[model samples]
Target: MSRAGRLGVGIIGAGKVGPVIGAALAGAGHALTGITAGVDEERVQAILPGIPVLDALEVVRRSELVVVAVPRDELPGLVTGLAEVGAWQPGQLVLHTDASFGTGVLAPAAASGAIPLAVHPAIAFTGTSMDLRQLSNAYAAVTAPAAVLPIAQALAVELGCEPVVIAESDRLAYAEAIAISTEFSRSIVAQAAELLRGAGVPHPGSYLSALVHSTVDHALSQAGSAGAGPPAEALEG
Candidate 1:
């Protein structure tokens, strides 16, 4: 799909990442047709006011661009099911936000003539507008066919992200790197908080939160100045 003009977009999942990215794309001038409501209608409306909440398949049918932001493991099945039901439109754009898999996971939709794209933002989402700020400085891992690669990059840039093309062969490694940096860092912080609690420290979480924030900021600053990646200790600390 050539992003020559604003497109009608639909979100397949109402989870944390979906609404935020939908909102970001909306902010970038795309029209949000609808988003899947399920049991989270209230939550979805709260996050994305003015967008209609519709059934998953209905959303896909109405959209020129469909964003599949479901859990990673559910993506392939969802794409297959949609394709089986004859839901995908020819020349429509289908994007998945899974870091672990590249555009190949959307093969079913691709077979139906939907352009497949894998666009994974590197930053952790808080399911709020605050995440928009992080996106301005974050890198997004994008994978798509060469013909539509520019469209994928343009979409990432619209969401305030710098696009980094991740090869299909390196998808798992890229996903693992993000997991270690964000998830493992949280685990380390949790352990430190527990030790602080054992030592009878008052408000250990609050103190550690401030310390960690400063440490991360300093590490990022150092990495920027040094023109290199932060050391593992700096990242974990």
Candidate 2:
């Protein structure tokens, strides 16, 4: 719908992922009509100063594109509550960042005329001021109804991500794949830290992070090559 002119975006869960992505999208020019947070006023102000933190219902009532950034386990309950209240609007697009579930779980909202979308980012959110700095190279797995796929795609791109479309039915499987990758990297990082600890290397995390990034960059460059790029060009590069 002509990009919706920076969507009057409202975030229902101003928790870790919610505020971070909301802030990032706001930085990307979306009009963040504040956010919904159950936290006390002091705590809410600590995150986003001078921004009006409304109640969940109010967040939905105000925005044309409402993003439910609550944890995956909380999604069904949250959305169900919103659906029961008739708070969702017909033209409002409902998108969530849970990797394990799809729009099927949000069928109630869809039935209520909101476009349900599963647009999970591939990166973990720390819910801090640093979030905006970490948004580069973010990737997302998006599953949406055919009619609303463009909406999902546009939002993902706005987040500076390479969005990969997957079937809604396969969301859980894709989540598993991501789980394995994240765990593998995390496990390796843990082991590397231990090894460095034993070797008496100070601030091992810095070295370990750099090593991982270099390896990944080299591997990505190698993969980008079509033919005979002199195998293991990474080490040479």
Which candidate comes out best when scored by lDDT?
A: 1
State candidate 2's TM-score. Answer: 0.83
* Tens digit of per-residue lDDT, candidate 1, span 142-228: 889989988888898888888888778889998998888888889989999999999999888997988999998998788788966
Name the runs in model 2 displaced over 4 angstroms. Answer: 1-4, 38-47, 219-237
Q: Model 2, 26-112: lDDT tens per residue?
A: 767888786876555454556566777888889888888888888778899989988899988887889998899888988888888
Task: Kindly report which residue pairs in candidate 2 clash with one another.
Answer: none
Give the TM-score of each candidate: 0.90, 0.83
In candidate 1, how many clashes are counted?
Answer: 0
For model 2, state the Cα shift of residue 26 in Å. 2.0
Model 1: colliding residue pairs: none
Q: In model 1, how large is the Cα lDDT of residue 213? A: 93
Tell me the TM-score of model 1: 0.90
